[model samples]
Target chain A: MSGFSATLGHRSYEFADLRVLLAKATPLRSGDVLAGIAAGSAEERVAAQLCLADVPLERFLTDMVVPWEDDAVTRLILERHDPVAFASVRALTVGELRDWLLDYDTDAAALSAVAAGLTPEMVAAVSKLMGNQDLILVASKCAVVTAFRSTIGLPGRMAVRLQPNHPTDDLRGVAASIVDGLLYGCGDAVIGVNPVSDSPARCRELLDLLDGLIHEYAIPTQGCVLAHLTTTLRCMDRGAPVDLVFQSIAGTEATNRSFGITLELLAEAHAAARELGRGTVGEQAMYFETGQGSSLSAGAHHGVDQQTLEARAYGVARAFDPLLVNSVVGFIGPEYLATGKQVIRAGLEDHFCGKVLGLPMGCDVCYTNHMDVDQDDMDSLLTLLAVAGCNFVIAVPGADDVMLGYQSLSFHDAQYARQVLGLRPAPEFEDWLTGQGLLGTDGRLVMPPARHALLADPSGRPSSALPPG
Target chain B: MIPDEWSALRAMTPARIALGRAGSSTPTRARLAFALDHARARGAVNEPFAVADIARELARRSGPAVLSVRSAVRDRDEYLLNPALGGRLDDASRAEVDAAAGHPGTAPDLVVVLGDGLSAGAVNDQGVAVALAVGDAMGERGWAVGPFVIVRNGRVAVGDEIGARLGARFVVVLIGERPGLGATRSLGAYVTLDPRPGRTDAERNCISNIRPGGTSVADGATRIVELLTRARAAGTTGVALNP
Candidate 1:
């Protein structure tokens, strides 16, 4: 293309045709930028090497509670990778196991390979982020434990979250559909469902549904399935103290999904601490987890825009309620910012334990060996997150979710929180980890919260960091 | 509007740019090929081509007085990633444009070019309206507009390069807008003073977009005359005194 204006002496550009342009085009947009950050490149590499023996996280969550399930993924992997058993494994069996892997697996590697790659630091982290399960069984058990120990401890917050508007797609809408709408959708695959609506308008509809079921309960809750919803501090109505989840700008970007889960626990505990401080001990759990745990999409990494930062700072300024985020999901991987680390460390040095916790969802391998964050200095960082008030860790059975994995193992955070904090054992932990399925019965470990004896108890006090003779 | 006399203008291929296969309906494929080839050929030799060249093969037009046009896009970081700054070549852009101008005193009448390397699709979506707006903006003073140029994979420099070459006293680049998720294609504008590449955004006068939200080129006509009149008076273009 060429041209020139005699008087103006200006040149003009031309195009030979349009079809050539179409040939060179392949629909492009900004979302594609997150293709790898969410779950890609790293998945393939990590999946190939995982083995059941290394699933460190799987072990701690259900240590002897209900029961454990056999490692279906591992068994299938073994049957294939193992030349001796390859032929013995039937096509139908492999297909079923493959389907299971698709449902539960956060990566592509075998379970044992996942374990072998872990460093000691990662093991501690995965072990911690193992709670926050949605299994009806675990939630009921934990609620009972928390209820019994109400006078002495703040058991664990049984938080739930849901979006108000039920969009057929995306994480927020899906979670909300199940929780508030009570309608089953894609959300059942990711988070649990609750029929409770926080919006006054929608709640009225729920109240109507409860008209017939009220034959036995007090505050109409027939259709109100307990769900988690997070709102900005400003959004909270001082009078009613409730807000829808999506409206709150917390974790708006993809990197801050943990904020939602942590908020869930904080909401519950903070409200209780205030009431208990005021001698209102029997206020019926103060609608804690019913409207907590609003997690961000954790889908994009636009690096904190102005809006995103404002939202985060706002959430932080407002102290967390102890009910939903009674526990936090801290970062032990590459995404951990110095800013976040400083805040968490201050909380720890100041000795605020019940407020937040860390579970190294993404271990070193997930970061570098796996290529997620590329942070060579991650091993030492894990120690810092732990020091910052992180109690439970979430490593795989024998493996650790490395940094390069990003949030590939983030789901494990809730697992460790529920398993370790609530003190439930194998079967219960197993049930939630793998869901209530046939395989949910094997290889579970639900180590109960070791209680301390008033007299000479090893359980009551933290183990002597003083070293054995 | 080749001067009523230099109408016998013949086409010439630029020394720096390579003409790819223009064997199709749209030149975009050829543009993309050029970019990819430049990148690949320059391989470890370099990472980014940083420069591209394409001349309008107008069958017949103006005389050959050898002119250079280019824009020094200041706040490079902001422009590369930001969709908002697409309207004008930043301060640094002016400096670069000035430097590229072998002769800055001889200003050209019109500087036309495409910009905001967002995407060709974005340009197609937003550029046309912006062009019309610029045209209307230039109409008030009865300042006659010449021809328009749209470059693919274009950044601010392409404007500077052509403006410098065309020898126009005034030049404006209607560029492509950055593509977001829902709004992938949009348009922008860039104007240059003295129609030279090295001059800064301050030296130039611009009413972006041939459409609203910008000084539509149609509306820009009167404004362009006013700017030229002011430049003729102030003898400069910068933060201090630009029309």
Candidate 2:
């Protein structure tokens, strides 16, 4: 038994070499490739042996890359670390992996990395292969929620948003989603509406309905109809309660103008709302939304990069001292981001930038269908944001923003985050939930007696939660 | 045969209605002219208003003193994204307006605010000229108008806060309207009674398309006086007071 003094320095093997290795090299035969690398002139052997992995690539790569003489090379190899790990994950049948992961319970970062490493097509394939139970088990295993100190608007607490959007301000559809969200233990932080109509009268109706619900149910949440500042101002003037002055903010003047918003206008709106005592819970009375691609979309980037422009938007939001500042990263579409990889990277960048700027940063972990993304992509981004101490995520029904036509986290998704990550709703909201007997001691919903009445009717009629129009 | 009607209409207005066609498409010349106008419109929206320069220009031109103020929007980017912000004065601008309220005998019946609404080109082109005509008309009417304030990055509602803060009964904000292909430099005068924040657009009377080609500067200024007089007397501007 002659031991070869192998000092492999290369970072990766060639694909053709890998293909050949996969076709011919058994575990025993894989040792032959390793031995070849160990012999004199290991670089050439390593290059050729990168092929012929009849053995699992993970096993093969780990064997080859981990023992490199240079630590830098080892780290570089680790950077491409997913292939080996992925190969191992790929080796398990859906049932086998699901059962194993259910009881696995370790640092979820690795599982997330594996999930992230798989392509959307691959993830879709896995989903199709797995039973419903197994798929859920795997998802729970993949969520990694680290305890983050600073929170969104409130300090040191995780918050969840309930976004009940309606195209025509239909009270029934709006109430149903709200009811659904509340049943899923949401809306303690903010129960805001995304209104398609820019009409002040329509907005007033939406605001009135939301305000009515908040009081009627004693739901501990702030409500806002994210209409234009002018409309919200009208709502206040008409003696309707304006909970939050919402605006889509941007970094540059031209872009902000494109959205029909200006910081000065926001100040005026804030002043109007504050004068009316709308934001009684906190000093800040505004909710601002921003994203990376808006400046570019509005043709107002001013030659600055998207991320820097996004940070500048945070600067604008901070200047207003807003209660909620959301960065809807991938909602813009593929013309700006082009792919989920880009979207995921941009989401992380925006979140980090907002957090650094001391913003109560919540990411709209979302993507439109036109963009190259899937549920798995959102999950990867969501898990990472949760780990990074994101304040809250938007919860629409079925992961679909029906009005905005974008895909975002659903209430069930929030449940998954809470259950698997040991996270809970915002503290004040949690207390209200517990006191109301909506949430149990174990951080799950207690099956409200009025659940059936509150949920949306299949006939598209208003549920019992819908107040008299 | 080339239509004589289109040429006649083209002679009358800059509107695209008179554009002649080449086999179901606009003629090459007409298309090029449309493209040129579109470019001008784009340029008008993108151009930055030099607030101090406009103030200097207005002050140098004569009549009332020009006081420079700004909307809550800090810069061009902010001014664009948040129209609500553009509708109110920033703290510094508010302080300036507030300080002006103490300027004895300067509290006039009308407060004129010159704003770069959507087109800086329009403000640069005709804002000062229009303000002068409006001032001359108000002077003849014996209405004591306050010093002119050039509001940088302002919307229609921006004048409300300026007027309220200045202790004026009326505010005449001459802002640039969103530019159209045929009219890149159209200026509009928005008149409000008892001006303050949260005044709806319907509460204001707007005189739009003030330009060399549209409403002449003198005509616009004259119409503003008419609206102002009616607004003050009627205690309203938009629906309640028809000028």
Candidate 3:
């Protein structure tokens, strides 16, 4: 079958024969005809031409010269982008930002700084205008350093966080999620729980249980009950086994005060936790969480942009020499960032800024219900952040963070990342998993010989069939 | 291009007063600006002050030193909820101020204190500028200035007790103003003569909106010093003392 011809720039080229489209019976323009043929073909020769040929994709789209404007072909060609939204984004510059994004060879840090310098709305709009190829080009060309920083108990290996949250402080329900994640070869960096009850005693009880789990399973994971520094300090005073001290920090002093945390207090908590020497694997014993919205939400941003303020919070977090500093990116609802596009851009900016600041950065790729997001949105963001060399990701059961009332990565999502991205759990935890016959030498997970007994009994004897570590 | 109808008007102020709308909604640019400003307003109200940090910064900037004090308001939460409590000093704070006042060379002809007020962020951003300007203006006029004091969980009137304790003839307070959408970093100055604990807002004269956009620090400082001079001569502030 004959395919259509189109003029791109100054050159005229013929598209390859779209083998599946038998006839061109319509009076559509060559672009529209090519789009329909592209949509209908098994080989997708026309679609390939649209990408591979010197087709001037941006120019063609910007000219608004579509013959069949209402057709699916036109929509696909435009990436289903909102015309008004794209126009607004394009109005910012004459393809300067797009060219910057397209220049994959540009320094990742430079690109990140540029990305961060943009307003959140600009970032969000640009991201919405990007096609799959544009995203891939951007993600692939960036540097990927394996484990730029490490948490305690994990050394130069990709880590996964197990967030076992429960509404009633039920250890059993929390244990179920933790066991599920652990069995899937997750929870290498830390097993941090967001507890529903704010009581120090209740948090201390959960910390004690995690301590027992870590020892009994010989899991190379530190435990943190995400209570306030004061609550965690009280837990320490009571001689509870607290592995990592946790605090919610913001950019400015006043914002920290509103949250009842101060830099001096953080320093004190860091020193107290360090003196306790609870973490067995690494020297650092503090963990911090920050987000762009907190400063504004807490009324302390000082009229500084949220990204800059967020970076300032990282400065505060890094001073404590934390084991892991995760940006709960979209955990705050839509008030600060209204859509998934904004959340993803903020996640990348946070990752880049945190990495630049020399902190072991991770992202709780999450969103509340009020935001314009879903599981798929989180999946896309999680994949991009992982590819951006994020230190760790939050792994909860079923992508549900019940206690926090948000959605995060699921245990399966962790496995999927390791499989697709060639990422591995923290080295020590990987060794433990292999010793338990749960992971093969190739780093792929294997069915346990005795799945039932292993989960039921944390102290169960190692199977003789287990691979020697 | 046709001249924008509001071009000259918009240049006069940062406030989005006469921005044209689009079919009953704010235009995209105007709406986004409004949102950003609204966010700034919210941020100012919610920010907390690390009083020690501000004091250390003040000490670094100049001499005399910086003293830390607290109001009767126990914490930021209480301070936000109970405006009345923020107006007075706590017992321990009173003792500290009195003890410090007893130290030799601590008393001065003028006492200045900075408070976190409704916008701690404002105080942090503009407090130092306004304070330096006031101090330099006072120094040039040959007025003896006391150590800079930073009070946490305090309102504007808390400076009265601080000034009275030090036995200064005049007290000047630079506090974070209640933020507006366009002016989150505005710091307000409250000047009083013969400072006492029971002084009310009516007994003090205010020079407000002291920031880059509203009132420049130099102008605000001059206003404060001028008000103080007049208040000292009149032996009063408020309606009785005119600049």
Q: Please give the C-alpha DockQ score of model 2.
A: 0.01
Classified by CAPRI criteria, candidate 2 counts as incorrect
Q: Sort by lDDT, best first: what order?
A: 3, 2, 1
- Give the higher-TM-score candidate: 1 or 2: 2
How do the residues B140-241 of candidate 2 rate in per-residue lDDT, one tens digit apiece? Answer: 889887879988888888899888888888899988876654567789898888888878877888888898877898888888888887776777778677
List runs of model 3 lying over 4 Å from the truth.
A1-157, A451-453, A457-469, B1-243
Candidate 3: what lDDT? 0.64
Candidate 1 chain A: 10-residue stretch with minimal lDDT:
A181-190
Query: Which structure among the candidates has the greatest TM-score?
Result: 3
lDDT of 2 at B183: 65
- Give the range of the ten consecutive residues with the poorest summed lDDT in model 2 chain B: B4-13
On residues B1-243, what C-alpha lDDT tens digit does candidate 3 reach at each position? 111122222222222323333421235675466456555665776687867777877788876667898899877655654455787888988888887774666468788899988788878887877787777778788888887888887888788889888988888998987665456777889988888887866788999888776788778888888887777778898867754
Q: Estimate each model's TM-score.
A: 0.28, 0.46, 0.47
How many residue pairs clash per model? Answer: 200, 34, 8
Q: In model 1, which regions exceed 4 Å deviation?
A: A1-182, A186-231, A237-241, A244-469, B1-96, B99-116, B138-243
The better candidate by TM-score, 2 or 3, is: 3
